[model samples]
Target: MRTFQHKVTINDMGAITIFGLGAFFCLWNRTNSLMVILGCLLIIVTIRAVDRAIHTSYVLTDDSALQIKTGRIGLTKHILLSEVKSVEKRPFAFHLGHYALIEMMNGSVVSVQPDNVDSFLSALKKRIEKKDNEV
Candidate 1:
């Protein structure tokens, strides 16, 4: 089994922080409380996103299942290799860019960006192929 921990890029955190603060300032002291609420929501969203990213981790099992876990919200997902339709590796763009997109047989998609994406993909392919041989 191989495990990878996702780290939130500094650039991403900085960008989100700046944007959230800007929104809060713009909406502050507004006549209606609705605007303030909206600003707070924005900031909350930013915090959640960053928190999730920081806590996200992946586990690749020998049986060809990839487990995604986010400690922040206690979210866990398992994607079986047999059910995966396709896997795409994307070159990193900005700080918050995702590395891989896994499409499942049920038409749903899961996105993950492990710290070492190339190695993750290589290991995943090997595990999937090994499972197929066993089957």
Candidate 2:
């Protein structure tokens, strides 16, 4: 199996900035119990997001499946390599990060964001070719 780390992008930074500001303001005011609770919740959620981002990775398995562990909420998804028709690299509109759009045989597309677009594409293409040859 080949593993790739997830790169920290602008989305992550934005989340931290927004959440931090909210939490800071809420805690600083010390207005009411509800606001304090909400601030605490935001802090917890932000920490969880940071932790997930640090540990997130994409795994291309030997069984012709790609395992995705996204940083957001620790979501995990699997896509069968055999079902993939093609992969195209798409850059973010803001030019912050890169994602690969995988077109499936079922006419569905799944986008995956990886740390290194070229490396991820190379590894995925190699696996797909190997799987194709075995069939």
Q: How many steric clashes between backbone atoms does each model show?
A: 0, 0
Per-candidate TM equals: 0.75, 0.87
lDDT of 2 by residue, 1-135 (tens): 889998778887789778888888888887899889988998987788787667788899878899988766777889999999999899898776788889999999887778898999999999999989999
Model 2 lDDT on a 0 to 1 scale: 0.86
Question: Best by lDDT, which number?
Answer: 2
- Whole-model Cα lDDT per candidate? 0.78, 0.86
* lDDT of each residue in 1-135, candidate 1, tens digit only: 889888576665777788678667757766688877777777777777777767889999876789999767667888889988878887556645558788889999987878877787788778877877888
- Which segments of model 1 are wrong by more than 4 Å? 7-11, 26-30, 92-98
Residue pairs whose backbone atoms clash in candidate 1: none
Please give the range of 10 consecutive residues that has the lowest summed lDDT in model 1: 90-99
RMSD (Å) per prediction: 3.2, 2.0
Alpha-carbon error at 52 in model 1, in Å?
Answer: 1.5
